[model samples]
Target: MAIRDAGDQPAAGIYGLSIETEPMEAKLAKALPSGEGWQYEPKWDGFRCIAFRSDSSVDLRAKSGKPLGRYFPEVVALLADLPTPNFVIDGELVIEVEGKLSFDALQMRLHPAESRVRKLSRETPSRFIAFDMLVDTDGMPILDKELAYRRARLEDFRERIEADPAYLTVSPATKNLREADAWLSRSGGDTDGVVCKRIDEPYRPGERAMMKVKRLRTADCVVGGFRYERDSELVGSLLLGLYNDDGLLDHVGFTSAIADIEKPELTARLESLKGGPGFTGKAPGGPSRWTTDRSSDWKPLRPELVVEVKFDQITGCRFRHGTKLLRWRPDKKPSQCDFRQIGL
Candidate 1:
């Protein structure tokens, strides 16, 4: 099953020894694309990397087009030692902590200090989860090949060159929609979501040609506060809050999807309810220098308004990103928006 190294050097240009191929991307979708000709894979929650190896060169590039080999020296060594040469692979750079994938540990590898990077690599070595094959050992660029054939070649390559489990892993793919849904339900922690691609689609670099479905769950939260647009009197974002175990209202996240036409009215309404309690449990403290202009103009509110919003992921008792306002829930009381709804 080994792909023969037709030449000592990689193919000339982007997929060559000096690999610089842009990784393919996926589009966010509310639901998985249905019907036939779709292959699903886990959307790994780590840095996206494209790995390449030639006769004497092994390079890893982050999705940001930055060099990753300096930070992931262990991965570089593993790729260098592999028997198969002149190949490029698209994958995620992940590190496991106590049998669970740790995205934080992977992020810590990006330090400028070489010593720090080396220490972390030794403490929690990174693993490349190969999801797709871009170039073969024969130094042939297969970016134009259909995914069905590319997957077959990748599987074949895996069979021939069994990578070390400690430093590398082959990401699993399936055609079953049920399995993908199961993965989506389990999205959080190590898994972020599920990625779906057309079976016959060729890799489209730097484009959202593939589909990704994330877990979008709804929550009823209290509009504990609101932020004004940097230069306008309109509402920019609504600070959401929920009661903790001790019955203290904690700011969980924010929603900023208020329509332009409704902003003036909503702003006036929110202004009238100002200065009761922004967040009792944990307030939006003084802004850091890095705070965005919009986030820096927040105002404490009465915490009397209740709103329903949709969120994808939560971490450290806070929403990972800004939520989308679904509707105002006057029927649901703010006290009812408790921490019990979310499983920590």
Candidate 2:
């Protein structure tokens, strides 16, 4: 994949996609089968990063190919200060406190001020838990090599690097399926799910070369305002609304994991038909049971996008978990995004 030029654009987080980036998805298995070709590992709950190091310069990019260097200055400094400075690595960016991953600390890295970022870098710094070796010290891509070989190379590199609890580390993997299953079940803390990869498979960059299993669930939502991350950009999140008999677009939920990456572009095309009373009935009123004064954060848009979110659970009408971001259906009208989809 071609390297994207990192400019002033917001580092692609959940809403953006890297130009060469492929969505990481899993193929559903009719039944969980055991096989020699498969190797399972604990899926981590953290940011996906591709670290590019060239001599003294290091760029930590998000899965969306956005430069994450600013958000993680300590990671950049650590990578630049590494023993080998000309290798590219793929890994998860996480913060482990008391041996458990802390995603809240990771989210704090998204601040806008450089001074604050630098300060936080010193205090509560981040760690790069490497899992794959994309490039070797010779500046050649090694993604075509088998997983066993890559694991050996990664182990060697980890051994050579200076250990900094806040900046760099290695992610451990187990080949035992039961152990992997155990990690999947131990929730409540930080384990996101389980990822199964082929031991002999070569690193298929920009491909869904692995299988991910998460505890899947679903929710019903109302389509509210559709905000574009940027002007002319595709819809970022479908501002979800719920209704009462009075008829209004109430700020209730949002579905961002629309599987259709290009769906937002199509949604923009349909905005021309937006002027009608999108949500009629009792719209979102004051703060709900979970929110505070932020109730006003919502905006009213023409109700035209309806989506069913295969989510985990709900705190209220809002998803208490990170949504999988499924695909968009033009076939389903806006009004179809309703409470019936909400799990009982």
Candidate 3:
């Protein structure tokens, strides 16, 4: 395999990476297709990092080709202490809080201040879960090698060099269909879903060659509120909510899948139901630094309308992303829309 630079030019000299290497990518699939050629692993919900440890240095590279060494110093230190003289391993940086994987803690490590990063590194710390090997112990490039070979080498390295399983360990893999389905079924909080790869397929760097099947489930949500377009009365997005155990409607997420023609009718219907106490449980608007300008500008509505939406995952008691609006569930009652569907 001919490795190329960012400019698409052929890489110079040896494959000795000096803080540079494009990581292989994966494609998203709705379902994991069955076959004997498939290898499945849990899709960890954390920063994807590719570690390069040389004789003199060790570097952690993110999926977007960004440097992560400054943020995750503890991981760098662990990589430096590895028994291997030099090698490249692909893995994820995860921070666990209270026995559960915390993505928020991983995000907090991206502090600009070195002091803050250092503090968090000592306080919470991070772990590296190796999944693939792009460079072998002999310092030979293995981009042309198949997934089965790379996976075996990666596992061997973990068993040999990664003596301490606390900070560095190889992710578990399975080829059994029943076990793969179990991973997908229980994917949340820590594990995002299951990633299936063809054992015979070579790692295609910067390409979506591997397939990923995330946790996708549908929920009937109460349309408790909505946000109007800046200049028009049309609906920008439908605010979604689910009743908590205390009978309080909590704003989980929203969907902007309204058709242009149906907007007028939807807007009118929503306008009629405009009222207070839309979200009794965890209402929107807070000291969140990551909010949009319209985050505080949602129009509250009567908890009467219900919608069926498909969502991938829920994190921090909210939808990880905007749920896809499936249809207006007129047959479903808003009272029926509860967190029970998500088993929350």
Candidate 4:
């Protein structure tokens, strides 16, 4: 894919607006923002997509302004078939498997081969959950309009196109804080958390004008291994693992939120039990695009120690990001730390 600079002139699409228009961003908040003008919606855990339909041509752009048309051909075709020929909609591109959203299936669409992408699209078709509209069906840009007016325009646009909830659907939003809290409490398998936006505020492009709170959960995991600091011998991160149904421990994730004052004693304590195989099922991998040279240089442990970790999302049986070290789970046994705790 060709890289486009942020300052470059965006290519024009429907309603004379660029298909690669910068998406509005959200600031991560510890708690949901409460106010009179706040509108809450379920934060879908999928690819942030800005879809544009210009006559027969449809373009799907990622939040980073990268072209996603090749990855999701079914979604492109769905938009092209809409009754409204010219429009720009902001939403998420999600894939569902077994009646639940599977982010791993959505990531599989990023294949380089077109044949493989087409095969996966057939096996696991994706859905476009519409949330916002930048261009109306009348081919007019509504960037300066308030979100309350824009949402009405989006609903009318969806009605004109007669979007099917199975493929193309409008996302539900509410103004009540109680309903928003309920959505956050039931967040899992489908929604990630809750996104609160100002109903009276105009569209602010490429700005953190919205607030988002992610649903966090805790899990007990076995201390499978430990990685040392870049140059020092002190412990840096603790590799976490959980036992599978087959009785083999798999590397789930790691936590590096250790306090500096405890590194000396912790390093010494970890070094004493570093001889056995750490994770019997899946182990840490070598250096990759997201890893350092010392990522694979980890010392295996006896899997006797257990630790509690706080995490947000898990994809393909592994934590999506580095976990937060909560506390030592000395009261919890290594065998008690299994995938069932995470609803595997």
lDDT of 2 by residue, 1-110 (tens): 12222334433331122223432323323223366777666667677888777665556667555567888876776777777766777888887777788777776777
Give the local distance difference test score of model 1: 0.78
Candidate 2 error regions (>4 Å)? 1-33, 97-99, 216-344
The residue ranges of model 4 lying beyond 4 angstroms of the native Cα positions read 1-10, 217-344
**What TM-score goes with each of the models?**
0.63, 0.61, 0.63, 0.64
Residue range with the least summed lDDT across 10 consecutive positions in model 2: 10-19
Cα lDDT, all candidates: 0.78, 0.61, 0.77, 0.82
- Candidate 4: clashing residue pairs, number: 0
lDDT of 3 by residue, 124-184 (tens): 9899998999888888888789999999888878778846787888999999989999999
lDDT of 4 by residue, 1-344 (tens): 23232123445765778776777767656688887999999999788888877676677888767778888888877887777777888999889999899877887887789899999999999999989989888888998899999999999887777767899999999999999999999996599789889999878777667877767776779999998877787888899999998999999888888998999999999999999789999998753233452445789999888887898888999999889996674434587677765657
State the TM-score for model 4: 0.64
Pitting candidate 3 against candidate 4, the one with the higher TM-score is 4
Among these predictions, the greatest lDDT belongs to 4
Candidate 3: residue 207 lDDT (0-100): 60
Q: Between 1 and 2, whose TM-score is larger?
A: 1
lDDT of 1 by residue, 1-344 (tens): 22212112433444542354667777557788779999999998777888877765777777655577888888887887788867888999899999999866876776789899889999998888989988987888888899998888888887778787677878889999998899999997688789899989888886657877767566778898888877787887888898887888898888878788999999999999997877889876543233354747568888778876888888899888888886665433476576655543
Which residue pairs come into collision in candidate 1?
none
- What C-alpha lDDT, on a 0 to 100 scale, does residue 305 get in candidate 2? 58
TM-score of candidate 2 relative to the true fold = 0.61
